[model samples]
Target: MVLLERAMPTTLISMLAKIHGENPVVSEAKGVVPTCTCALMPKSGGKQGECKWCWRILVNREGLWFRVLASRYGLVGGRLKRGDRNGSVWWRDIASIRDGDASVLGSWFPENLSVHVGNGANTLFWLDRWVDDVPSCVRFSRLYDLSENKLATVAQMFSWGWKIGGEAWKWRRRMWDWEEEMVVECRSLLLTALLQVDTEDVWTWTPDPVEGYTVSVAYLTIIDRTPPTNNVLAALLWRKDVPMKVSVFAWRLFRHRLPSKTNLFRRGIIPSEAQLCISGCGQQESETHLFLSCTLFGHI
Candidate 1:
């Protein structure tokens, strides 16, 4: 347990509690606030208005959104009821079946979510992302793809028996010997984790030491996904008093990553040879030749 006065944000530290299930309740920072403006309200269902942050939280199934939804729409009352704005209607609007909830959920709830399987009523057996930070279908795709009830919850699968091919054992689609073994293994894994019917399944955000989402963490997560850019010419490109659009173009030019005809040709997007410069120079156009050696261009 490495204690620190200031919090450090790293995917590694976040994965610690997730992979091992060592839940340490750290004291939240003083005067901490929810990343969402919805938290400011004494009570909320997001019916009247939801800020960008709250809407994102609801979409990701994180923070108050997850809690409210998991509580069977009883957590937050009023206009944001089951079929209302912040309920199933909101979910359907953003995460349609055609678009696939997995894609939408995946954008926010990456591998850092530690799903505490409780009653298993809401925790999907194969699809809802209950176990191992990934969907059971993804981990055991062979069995899941063949199984008839793809959206069945953990409770339903365990209680009524997993309806492979949507029928009882006598008339259900036959499973290969290996698939049977895999099914047994899958069942064993779920059964091993004692599900407390009294408790509801919870989705936790793991990036913060206190298990709360922060804008900083979210920002860093996005940066981590993007390829890093060189800062060598940043000072030159982002000069004081320069307009934003001009600075952006300057930055692109500095990096030689602009979608110019020559660059596009080099990237195989253009069929024309790289010899004819846009300025009509006879020499083969290159980043160095364009700005520095071209006979037509004035030196900066």
Candidate 2:
């Protein structure tokens, strides 16, 4: 079997070092034994990257922390019921940084977050994830990529006259056949949402059924977004007769993460070898060949 050092992220190994309990030392060794619960989780910044737990703690503070900070600084930011110019500016600056660690953390949010359009002053015309719970940019990505102005606001797009600081139509005057079709599609979609200029824009958090953000709801949202895996033969793993450890091994095997020669070679745990079959076949080793196809092992 592969050692835990070879399998888990290095940051977790470092965290395990700081824990002090009856079995204080968390080793790099791998076995079927369960780890101790007394291990202390590492704080914020660590060797590999900012802790995801820490990142969540920070991002979820958008509702409360920013307001407290803004009140202290004589400025405003974060989620709003009735959008104001100062609050809108504050949110735009923070939300649209569009890169690095902060951006990565922001992507963890599910599509459940939505905007309640009012005056449309605070809502971004294209970049923000709003239409049918998806960003207009993502929905009409091709058109967004081709558009001359990428950062236009919804108010600007809906405004009738350029005389009052409304944006003039900035799309390319000439369009290819495909682009023309996309434009038609965009027009059809946009025509359905009419803006109410007198009303104030409301940023809505819809992760919970009750219409507010909660720690539990956020945690559930994150859990719901786990990356999908295709474990086609997973049924064999949960059979009543199988040992728990064996089921775990079977699960890892399906993920192509078992400590096979090919996995070790691919994971850089061992140097490349020309052959791996115990029966002396010269073929390259892989999960498929090791468990299902190798002439010697397949029949076992």
Candidate 3:
């Protein structure tokens, strides 16, 4: 053994002490927070309000919303939990499922053509390759720009048109439908990572858009609000020459809220009055009510 010259820094010694098995006690990456299952509070389950992690990142988001199962050798495994809001931090997994979860891909598809019967084996093999369900499911796979820092929004679904006879997939129904479902499923997977919305709504997990079809989520976001009455309501978006309606302008101006033009005039215009009106108390509705002091406007 060689003789040591100087004592190591206490911080360095302490960091070394944190080593458990082969993993380090402390992570070097910034903007990353560690969480324990215990800290995860169940918003739905009986564990109502208790936080699960030792410390929670104030804005701990899950990144990219893509799916990957890291499993291998019964040692490492878990799903990439909240991939939506983008907790873009380096993750040092204590355990990962490197091969176990992905085994379906290798097992489902063999090198023999008999294994890929008419439509039966082929579809199963396709899904396994793409990490999709064997049966129908809304797929949302996408390639995100990790370096650009700007996120891309992939359309959630698109219809698949395949003709089995000539060009329409060339004269087959089962194959066409199978092919179509596969195409749409692939699109779904791509879109899930691209868009951030509560898919449980009437939208999401629906049929793909038809060819040459488009839908604006922006339009869906605008809530039905009260309309505006006078030219003052139109503000800059209004003029006889402009030929614009106050209601239409109101949406562009305030991003869709309220129930009607008159409602904006009465309730959303002033803050206290709407609250007071229902309470049978005192509240005034005015331009200041409509413009300066309303929760609906979102000016702040």
Candidate 4:
């Protein structure tokens, strides 16, 4: 049998242990806490100009795996572009997760992931949460809708100039007096925003900024956000005494992922008429019917 069923429980437990083992004090006092720089300092790349004092140097960039995805799917401002209909299965799945299509963790990534604007070259002007807690597109929906170039990056817009009569204010048509006031308000907000010409924009994971992103922490966060019923079901699904295949079967049954006739019909693997229960109960062979409501197997 496959190791999928047996490994899940052990993996979950290990992840939980790792999450619990992290020091609460260290995590909370991350940027404020001072540390000894005696032996841990870099040997070769000591201090370079203003980089030594800049916190952007500590921000982690995307890894090889993410870079590979970006290369295949296309990248916009150091982030993966939205996947199209012609994209591969893996890419589409990833895109769905990024777009908050996942039922369990809706909008988690977008809510937690924020950009620390530096040169502004690698941050979206309207979509990224750099200026405020929410994206500019959301905060100024009316202005965003009127904009001619909705896809402009922060640097691009800044270069064009963001002042009232600047070239960056390219709208579809003339704005009303109220809209002009809104633009003034928007410009006023950006007045204090200073862009560092040398530093590149950095993406930060809000949950654990110090250690950055980790699979264990992400998994734990997802589990914590899941509904109590789902958590309870998952806990009950992987029992130490249960056989691997049996556990797998139960999991599939519960998830409606088993190859039932109704599911097969839905996937176009079987004809609609052929989706009747094999037990001849004149009902669709769905997980609920086959496992719990079937007169033959259900009672057995």
Q: Cα RMSD to native, each candidate?
A: 16.3, 18.6, 20.9, 18.0
- Candidate 3 minimal-lDDT segment of 10 residues: 46-55
Q: Please provide, for model 4 over 164-250, each residue's C-alpha lDDT reduced to its tens digit, 9 standing for 90 to 100.
A: 678899999999999999899899989988999999987777777787665444544654675437665665467565577877886
lDDT tens digits, residues 1-300, model 1? 113212423333335445555442231322222223222223322211222233344335434334323333332211122345554434443333212333222344334455577887756677656756577778888877787666666776667754354231221477789888887677666555677889876655566537455444543453465443555245434655567888887667656787766788878887876547767868767665665567876244
What lDDT would each prediction earn against the true structure? 0.50, 0.50, 0.25, 0.62
Backbone clashes for every candidate come to 0, 0, 52, 0
- lDDT by residue (151-191, candidate 3, tens digit) is 11121111122222222122222334555565555445534
What 10-residue stretch in candidate 1 is worst by lDDT? 44-53
Scored against the true structure, residue 196 in model 4 reaches a CA lDDT of 94
- lDDT for each residue of candidate 2 in 1-300, tens digit (9 for 90 to 100): 125224545354334434522232322232111133212222222111222222222334332222322332322122222234544433332332221223333444434456677776666777666556677678888878777766666776777432323343456666679986776676666756777879866555566545565444554454366533444245435656557887788678646787777778777887887437666776667767765567887557
The lowest-lDDT stretch of 10 consecutive residues in candidate 2 is 40-49
Candidate 2: Cα lDDT at 230? 46
Models 1 onward score TM values of 0.43, 0.42, 0.19, 0.54
Model 2 residue 177 distance off true place after TM-score fit, in angstroms: 2.2
Q: Over 4 Å off in model 4, which ranges?
A: 1-67, 101-104, 223-300
In model 4, what are the clashing residue pairs, if there are any?
none
Instruction: Give candidate 1's whole-model lDDT.
Output: 0.50
